[model samples]
Target: MAATEHLLRQGSFPAFFGIVAIATLVIRYLYPDLFSQSPISKLPYVGTHVGLPIQKKISFMTNARKLLRDGYRKFHIYRTETALGQCVFLSRDSMVELLKKPDEVINFEKVVIKDFECKLTKLASSEPIVPHTIRSDLTPGLVRIIPRVAIEVARTIDNELPATDSWTAHNIYDKLLRIVAISAGSAFLGPESCHSEEWIQSAVGYTIDVVTGAVILKLFPSFLRPLAAKFVPAIKRVDRHRAGISRMMVPIIRERKEKANTPGYEKPDDMLQWMLDKAPEYGIENDEEMAYVQLGVGLVSIHSTTSTATQALYDLAARPEYFQPLRDEIAKALQESGGDFTKDSLYSCKLLDSFMKESQRMSPISMVIGKRILEEDVQLSNGVFLPKGTLVASPAEAVGNDPAHFENPDEFDGYRFYRLRQKGGLQGNLNQMVTANKQNLAFGYGKHACPGRFFAVAEIKLIVAHILLNYDIELADKSVGRYPNKFHGDACTPDTSKQLLFRKRLSGQSEI
Candidate 1:
C-alpha cells in the first residue's frame, strides 16, 4: 500500500508540469512578437524570415538604375537582423574617396582574401600574399615576356582553328579554354611541359574544379559548412583533380632540378624558371612543393584570361562591323614591327586595348568593388561606421554605369578611352577607368590591384590579333543580337554557351 501511493504521487507531478509546458507554447505561437524579442529569434528558423526583408530591399536598390530611368546618383541603405549590416552605395564623389584610402581603410589582402585562404584552401599556414606577391612576381615578368608568350600560344591556337573550320558548329567556350590553357600554361610553365596533353588538361580541369568548389563552400554557414563540404561531390572532384596534377608535376619538377644542377645547361625563359628562382625567398625549398606554387599561378592565369578572351571574342562576333577597324589596327601594329608580335608591337595596338577595356566595362567580373571586412571599428568619409567583421563594399556596377562619370554608359563605345588618350589627357586617368572608382572596377585598385593584369592584357591582345589575321570568324547563330548575360549575387558573366564560326582567311585578305 505504501509503494502504490509513492508511484501515484510521481505520476501526478509529471502530468502537472506537462500542462504548464503546453500552455507556454500555445501563448508563444499566438503572439510571435513576444518570442521575437528573445535571442531564440536568431536561431535559423526565425532568422530566415527576418533576413528576407533586408535581402529584398538590397536587391531592389542594386537593380534600380538599370531597370528605372531615375537619375539617382547614390543611395544609403541599412540592414538590421540581430547584427548590424550597414553599407553606402556611392556613385560620383564618394566613390573616389572610398577607393583613395585602400591601404588605411581597405585591408583587401586581409579582408577580401581572408575567407578564401582561411576557409577555403587553408593556405594561411604562411603569411597571406595576395595583392603583394601577385604584384611583385607578375609585373616584371609580364612586362618583359607576356607578348612573346602570347605570340607562341597564339601560333598554337591558330594551327588548331583550321580544323574547326570543317565542322558545322563548334563550342566557343571549349575552344577558348584550349587557347587560354595552352597560352597560360606555356607562359607559366616551360613549353616542354605545356605541350604535353596530360599537363594542359589536368591544369585546366583542376583550376576550374577547385575555384568553383571554393565559391560554393563560401556560401554556407560556418558551423554546418564543414559537414556539408565533406559530403559534397564537387569537393571530391577538386581533390581528385588536384591529386592528378600533383602526380604529373612531381616527376617533372624532379627532372628539372636534375637538369639545373647539370653543368652548361641553358636556363629556360618561362614563369616556371622564375618561380623556381623565387621559391627560396618564400621559404619553399622542396622541388615538388615549389611545383605546386607554379600550379597555383597556372590556375589563376588560365581561368581569368580564358573568361575575358571568350567574352571579347563573343562581342566581336556579335557585331561584325567592329571587326574591320580592329583588324586594321592589329595589322598596322604588326607591320610596324616587321610582321612580328613583339612586346612593343603589342602595346602599339591602342584600338585593341580600348576594345578590351570596353568589353570589361560593359560586363565586369563582379558588381562590387574592393570587397572587404572590417578588422576593427572604422569610419568612412560618408559618416558610416562599420563594426568588426562587418562586410563592406562599393558600388562597382552603379559607378561604372553612372552617366555623370561616363557619357552614355549603357552603349558600348570602343573608341571612348582611345579618343581620350589621343586628346593628350592623362593616360594614367584612363587606367583608373578600369579601377574600383567612379568609372570601372575590373581589376580592383591600390595595393590590392590585380598584379597579373599587364600580362593578361598582353596575352589577350596577342591571341585576338593572331586569330583575326589568320581566321575569318562569325557567330554560328547570326540572329543572336547580344551576348547572354549571367548574374550571381552581384557579379556578371558573359554567356559561355554561344558558338563562333571560324574559317581560314587568305594571306593577303587578313590585313583587310
Candidate 2:
C-alpha cells in the first residue's frame, strides 16, 4: 500500500510539470512583449505573459481623463486604433467641421456600432439602411406621440411609488430603470405591453445585456468576438433576450399586417402601426422583417431613454432642495392648463425642461459626439487637416464643463439653463453648454442631430414632473457615494450600480 501511494504521488508531479511547461511555451509564443519589462508587468498576478491585465486595468474613467488632457493641452487631437485596424478617435475642431458637411461626412454607424453586430445580427448587417429608416419612419412617430406617452408614463410612476408617509430611502437607480423601461416600452409598443411585467423586464434586460455585450466585444479582436460572445455571460444573456424579443414582437407584427391589408381597417395608435405604414416604402413588406425593425427600435429607444431617466432621477433624489422648485413649476403649469397633461402643459413647465437639460449637461451619455469618417481631406477653421477615413468628434463633456461658457460648471445647478433663458439668451447654444453647440454635439448636429430630440425631451419632462408631484424621494444611504460619472473612452452612461430610495407623498403634504 505504501509503495502504491508513493508511485501515485511521483506521477502527479510529472503531469503538473508537463501542463506548466506547455502553458509557458504558449504564453512565450503568443505574447513576448507582455512578458517584457513594461509598466503593466510589474503588477502582481498580472506579471505572467499570457493574460491581458494591463489593458483590462485601463478603466474607462482613466482613459477618458487622459484623452481629455491630450485633446485639450498637448496634441489637440486624440487617435486610437480600433480592433478592426481602423484608426479611430477625435479632433476638437473636426466635430464642428463634420456637421457642416453632413452629406459628405456622415456618422459611420457601422464602425461606431461594430461591437453590437456580434450579438444582434440584424443590426450588424443592415447598416446605412437601419439608420436611414430610423430617421425617416421611427423618428417621426416618436416625435408625434412622445407628449401623450410621457404623461401616461408619468401618471403610472406617480401611482406606483412605494407606500410611505415620510421620505424613505430606497435604491433610486433600480426604481428609475424600471420606470424608464416601462415608459419607453409604452412609447414603443403601447400601454398594453408596456405595463406588463414580463415585457418590461424583458426589454430592460435585453437592452442592458446587449449594450454590455457590445462594449465587451469591442474590447477584443474582431475574429475572437463570435467565439467569446458565446462564452461571455452578458453576451449569452443578450442572445437569449433577442430571441425573447423576436418571439414577443412576431405576433404583434402579424396582427398589424393582417389588419393593414384589410380595407377600411381602424388604425391602431402605436409604433407598430407607424412601422407597418412605412415598411412598404423601405421594401420591408414582410411581417417578420417589420417585426425585426420594431425590435431594433425598442433596443435603441429603451436603452438611451432609460439611462437618461435614471440619471435625472438620481440627481433629483440626491438634491432635495431642487425638488420643490421643479414641483412648483410643474404644478403651476398643470393648474394653468386645468390639470390636463397635454403637449402645451408640458411645454409650459420650463423649469422641468431646464432641470432635465442641466442633468443631461452634467451627465451626458457621451463626452464626444459627431463621429464621422473623413470622405476626403477636410480642413478645419483651426487649421488642422484630417486625412481620409479619420474619425472625428467634439469633446462635449470638457466643453460643457468649461468655465468660459458655464459659470460654476462643475456644480449641479438645476436652473442653469433657466437662468440663461431668463437673461434672454439662446437656450441650447452649443458653445455655451458642454453638449450643445454649433459645436456642443450632444444629440449630434446638423441634419442628423437626433431628429427625435423634441420627443425625448418632452417624454423626460412629463415623467419627472409626475414623479415629483406625487412621490417623496431621498437616498437610501447617506454615506454611499452619489452616481459616478460613467466613462467608456469618450462615451458615458449614468452609473447603474448606484441606488436611491423613495416613498409616496401623502395628500395635503404636497410641498410644492
Candidate 3:
C-alpha cells in the first residue's frame, strides 16, 4: 500500500503506468484471492487484472460491463481483486452454494461493516444486527404506509418538478435523491419534522458525505484508511451533517425521555420512535447513536431507491415506446385500488414492476453481488475451497445478462420478464422487483438479502407512477439513448448528472 501510494503521488506518467501494470500483475494476478487464500479450484483463473491494459483503467472504472461479461463467460469461478480486498467472483451455481452457508461460516454482516469501517467509523455493532423493525413491524403495516408514502411522493414531485408539461431539461438524479430522501423521510423520521429543509438536506448530505469518505478511504489499504481518512475533510463533512441531525432530534429524544415511564404515553408507530425505543438497549448510547440509525436507513434506502428509479426513468426517457404502456398500467392499477397507491395497487402494477426489474437487469446498480467474507474456511458445495477472510462476490451484472440466464440479454425488452413470468408461472416468485434469486441478485441471494427491498419496490413504483401519470419524458438530447450508467469500483449508480426533458401531460391526473 505504501509503495502503491508512493507511485501514485510521484505524478510521473511512467510511475503511474508502472503502478497499474505491476499492481495488476502482482496484487491482482500473482496474488489473487485464490492464489493468496489457498483457493483450490480446477477451473480457469479469470481475473480483471489479467490481460487488462493500463489504458483501460479509466474505461473500466466507469464501465466494467464488457470486462465482467467476458470474465464470467470464461470461468465458472474466478477471483476479482478490488480496492478494499480481493473477492472471488462466483458463477450462479457457486453463489447458491455460498449463500447456503450460515452466517457463522461466511459472515457478510461483519465483513460488510468492516469494508466501510473507515467511513461510517462509529456504527455501533459487534453482533448480528438487530433487524430493523421495518421488516417485522412496519412491513406488515406497509399497506397502511403506502398512502402516506404516496402523499409524500406527491408533495416532493410538486416541489422538485415543474408544472404540467413545462418542457424543462433537468438533472433528474439530483431531484430524485431529494424525492426519495424526503419521501422515505416521511416514514423514517416521522411527520412532525421530516419536511424541514435542514433535516432533508442533512439526511441526503450525510449519506453523500459518508460515501465520499468511504470512497476516499478506499484508495488506501484497510490498514492505512483509518489513520489517513479518519479526520479528513470527507469524514468531517459526515460529522458536521450528523451534528445537524442530532440538533434536530434532541427535542424529540427529550420528549420521548419525558414520556418514557408516563402512564398515559403511547409509543409512536414510526422508525424514529423505533430507533429511539431500541436505542437504549441497542446502541443509542448517545445522541450520535440516535442519528446513526436514521442515517443508516437513509443511506441504503434513499441512495439505492434513487439509483434504481433514475436508471428506470432514463430507460423510459430513451425508449418512448415504453412510456404510455407503463402509464396505462399504473392508471389501471390506480383505478383497481380505487385511485390509491395501496398494496393491491402495487400488485396490480405488474407491467411497472416488470419495467423496474428489466431496467435493473439491463443496468445494475452494482457490478458484483452477494459479496461475503469467509469467516470459517470451508469447501463450497461446488467443490471450490475458499479460505478464511476471502472476499467472495458473484459477477451479478454478467450473470443477469448471460445468454444462458436471459434470452435476448443485450436488448432492452421492457416486458421480457413479465412475459416470462406468465409463461413460466413465476408469478409467485422471481418476477417481482423485490424477489432475489440466483438469476436476479440485485437485492442479493440469501438469508441476508436486503431487508429494505420490499419498501424500495413500493417506493420506486409510486414515484414512477406519479411521474408517468403527470408528465411526458424524453432524453434532453435524442442522441443520448441508453448511455451506460457510471461505475465506481463494483458499485454502479445512475449518472444523475445527465439531463432529461419533461413536459407536463394534461392527462386525467395532474400530480398524484
The prediction achieving the highest lDDT against the true structure is 3
On TM-score, the candidate that comes out on top is 3
Listed per model in order, the count of residue pairs whose N, CA or C atoms clash below 3 Å is: 0, 11, 3
lDDT (Cα atoms) of all candidates against the true structure: 0.62, 0.63, 0.75
Query: Candidate 2, residue 360: CA error in Å?
Result: 1.3
After aligning candidate 3 to the native by TM-score, how far in Å is the CA of 410 from where it should be?
0.5
Ranking by lDDT: 3, 2, 1
lDDT of 2 at 314: 79
Instruction: Give per-residue CA lDDT, model 3, range 128-225, as digits (tens).
Output: 22355777656787988889989999888978997654689889999998899888888887776778776788878877777677667656556887
Off by over 4 Å in 2: 1-61, 73-75, 80-93, 115-122, 125-147, 158-160, 261-264, 425-436, 506-512
Candidate 2: 10-residue stretch with minimal lDDT: 40-49
Candidate 3 is scored at a TM of 0.87
Residue 505 displacement (Å), model 3: 0.5
The C-alpha stretches of model 3 lying farther than 4 A from their native spots are 1-37, 40-43, 47-63, 123-130, 221-224, 260-266, 280-285, 424-427, 508-512
